[model samples]
Target: MHLLIAWCGFVGAWLLFAGPIYQAATELEEEGFERDAFSAQIDTVEVPERPSPWWWLLPPVGYVLQRRRQTEYRRRIMAVMTQDQLERMVAFANTATGWLFVAGGAFFIALKETWELAEVYELSVLLFVLAVVVMFALCALHTIVRLRGTHQMLARSGTARNRDSMTDEPPATSDA
Candidate 1:
């Protein structure tokens, strides 16, 4: 099911954003440059393919999956964490979970578009610039969210670990 969603995302992105841009780039290159001059060039400028429209669907699908996973994760945490800690863990994971789908969609979409324009210099350059800006923005935002989630996880983990260590601590006997 996940694979199907991913494939749909890949194909949709190719069809929608990457394909048209690539077609445009190819046609543009053919206009002025000689077939061999443009053809033989190892690399070309191009925009990153637009992310898959199907990728838009990923959010809901991923949400369902995360909710399912959350149940299991909570079960595991039950033994070690306080109720508050468990709540924090679920909330933290939930917050950044959406980005996974977003990134996946963007990656697949961008890859499809970029891969086709591998040789069109001007087109490739334009695509690359656009892709870099967009990708960087996506990545920077995702990273910040993930870091926050991680910090929350670490806090809970530390609390759990301390509880364990305390359990292991021997009683201090009074010296008579």
Candidate 2:
């Protein structure tokens, strides 16, 4: 019964992921978005004009390729963001990572291999504690970074408001 439940969850996850992947691939084939996303995702080898019926999977293959691009894209995005943004993201990731580890442990325990854990209680305790510490540290960092960002934004807005108040309002123009 446990195995059946796991299989069902796996299938459900595949279906959940398939819809978006299919839509993205279809859009890529349709040339809806920029050509680069399509090209980046697609296999480098060019397809022949009269390919076999088995070639129907080319776009699906491209979908897999597109998914692979996410890591590099995220790195680029992180590089360009302000310090505040980076801190918030890191904090979020820290907390999320802790939870994911917990979830992974839960999943492992639920599966057949959990019997092995009975003898390794120390390892489990150590890992769980480490995850919790990292999560808490991230939470503290998040608070500090958020407070700084808020102060910076408030200062900029206050100056802008002062300058605007100092300037005379433009006279309204009537359309002919």
Candidate 3:
């Protein structure tokens, strides 16, 4: 009875925490598409093809493959981005990673305390697994947010450049 109650509580809390992260990640992904659109507008930029959804049937392999594609895409973006923009992304990645580590550490410590007090090995292991899943999800979301921000910056810079160039040229006066 107690175990069931604990499980329910844990699940409820996980849902509450993960819901917003998932929503934010989805929004960021949509925003990231703008970067691809911007690239498409350029004549020489080559966008990489996305991996097939069928790859997801093989979990470990699929994850690695997806990550490789994402890294390659990010590298392409970074290639044209300014040093200041790159630095901002690096700093954000560092800070988000640090916070995740701290949060994971605190969660583990609390889990340990709970295990010692309750001696519920089954529940402890379950909690540990869930925590790992949550941590990884958070990390993925953070990466998405960071990349989205970079994409936004790049898109804005491109727009500003286009605007400047448009304004710089003298208007053509056609002689009737």
Root-mean-square deviation of each candidate, in angstroms?
24.6, 18.3, 13.3
Estimate, for each residue in 1-176, the C-alpha lDDT of model 3 and write its tens digit: 77776655545444444444544444434533344444543435456787888899998888988899888877787787667666755665565565556545555544544444344444466766666566557656765776678879999999999999988978889999
Say which prediction, candidate 1 or candidate 2, comes out ahead on lDDT. Answer: 1
For candidate 2, what is the total of clashing residue pairs?
0
Score residue 77 of candidate 2 by CA lDDT.
Answer: 57
lDDT of 1 by residue, 1-176 (tens): 65555556545654454333333333333333333432333234232334445644789876666666666654543554556655654554454454444545655666754544433333566766675466455545554565567669989999999999988968889999
- Deviation in angstroms for 149 in model 3? 25
* Superposed model 1: Cα runs more than 4 Å off: 1-76, 119-176
Ten residues in sequence with the least summed lDDT for candidate 1: 38-47
lDDT of 3 at 170: 86
Each model's lDDT: 0.53, 0.50, 0.61
Ranking by TM-score: 3, 1, 2
Model 2 alpha-carbon drift over 4 Å, by segment: 1-122, 169-176
Order the candidates by lDDT, highest first — what do you get? 3, 1, 2
Give the best candidate by TM-score.
3
| Strongest candidate by lDDT | 3
Q: How far is candidate 3 from the true structure (C-alpha RMSD, Å)?
A: 13.3
